[model samples]
Target: MLDAGICNYVAISYGHSGLWGGGMRQLLFNTRPSEACFGHFGAVGRYALAAQRGMHEFSSGPETWKHIAMGQRKWANLNPAAIMHAKPMSEADYHGAPLVVEPFRLFDSCQMNDGGRAIIVTSAERARDLKHRPVLIMGMGQHNPSNEIAQARYLAGPTGAHKAGRAAFAMAGIGLDDVDACQIYDCFTYTVEITMQEYGFFGRGEGENWFQGGTIEPGGTMPVNTSGGQLSEAYFMGLTPIAEAVMQLMGRCGPRQLGPETRTREPQVILCSDNGGALQSHSCLIFGRG
Candidate 1:
């Protein structure tokens, strides 16, 4: 069951993005199973974008690209250990980066880094025997939208995220109100913005407003991306969010940990999301302590 859940999330997040017009597609097409396909997409997208725009290229994509780049810069400002820390680039610096794919600059794309993470799952009864408290997979949900990316009604909205969220809530027998914290994937800033709406954390097009209010910061209302996310943290396919969820539940996230100041309780419920393609696919899961 756990393998199946991982497969579904990976397919929605990494599989679709692999289809983008670049070497990522080639890597995915050559890989086996959906999870492996998605893993290669991140690595290939980084190399392809870097090669196309020249090693010096920094900014990438449209105006929204700049917005997300700036967001990452802000997060980096708070995280001194970040690879890109103390190196926030200005819009002019963004413009100076060689153009990779028209709008995508070097900084616009997620950095390709090396890292590995793991999680252990067991029945609530069996969890007591483990080294740490077990974070129950209280509610789990997955979704896949139509394959016709061109015909999809909302290019910017995460239709799959909405569907996956509903399914997860139903499985967990909980409502959005029960969620305490979130670890939604932030492969791109627009993705985080759109997902905030799709997950019903904010209204449509209101995600940017939520971001502006600092609701996603460590002590903010939602406390999102506590691990720096794909934006400020390392890119490890869609698995990074899974690790963050585990950390949140285990109370092991150091400075990124969301306290009572940010949340009413140590996060008992965590909502994690994964995005693939041109925001074409999504997957969600809700975790809690057993």
Candidate 2:
């Protein structure tokens, strides 16, 4: 595509000016919206309905939020570009903080802020010739279940990420167990927990157990979102997370870099995910050392 377009680089980026709404914006706005916000999927009632359908109940969801928050904070310190890099937080602060929705503390909800992120995409041949080490896009996939949460087939689970991940893995010729690190979507801390489970990184209903002992921490077996993700990093509609993935794969993250796993073992694969619309749509990407 780049060759055909006569373009050497293509940039993928997303920016939000949530506070900006001119007259043109109001003109397109509907007084009665027909669609539900993606947040509806993460709401408590949906979780309850999912439990009723025998999907593993997220009873321990709150506990997992703490680990994510703390783990993200630990890395935020190393990311100079992160917004929360200076604001340290601990499990105490997470629990003591007010709840956004029951079971979801304030820390669990991603804040809306003005931000922008960009990344350039080029042909593999062109990338290889570049001065810096290139981050290879091994495989990618996308899936959509429905536009409306009301039409979701499996409210208890089934975020469509599994299908996306499976397709990407097949294309990458890898397995879920083979992913060494992840930059999964973290619109809400629970999003990360659910994604890890749906993608088979952690056994169902075992998020809390897996996170214990810093399994997802820096240098841990399954380090995740090492750039603080949307939780602490500026949320750019998943663009920032994608950028972080490329950085980590290129081994350019100075302090936020994964611990030297090479002493005992070497990791050359990393996975990244982006979600759309109440978990109804998704995409996954795999990076490899080439």
TM-score per model over all chains: 0.69, 0.85
User: For residues 24-92, what per-residue lDDT tens digits would candidate 2 score against the true structure?
Assistant: 233223222432243332333333343333324555466766898888777776789888889989778
Q: What ranges in model 1 sit over 4 Å off?
A: 1-82, 85-107, 260-265
Summarize candidate 1's per-residue lDDT along 1-290 as a digit string, tens digits: 53544422221223223334455445334444453555533333433432233222322224534555555555555555455666766778766777544335566555455444555554566566767777888776676675544365554444688888888899999988888878777765556656667788866544444565455654566666666667666666677788888877887665555566334357889988886765567888898866
The TM-score measured for candidate 1 stands at: 0.69
RMSD values, in order shown: 8.5, 4.2
What lDDT is reached at residue 69 by model 2? Answer: 82
Give Cα-based local distance difference scores for all models. Answer: 0.61, 0.72
- lDDT at position 107, candidate 2: 83
Residue pairs clashing in model 1 are: 16-277, 17-277, 58-106, 58-107, 59-105, 60-103, 60-104, 60-105, 61-103, 61-104
Model 2, stretches more than 4 Å misplaced? 3-6, 18-60, 261-267
Model 1 lDDT on a 0 to 1 scale: 0.61
Q: Which residue pairs in candidate 2 collide?
A: 50-156
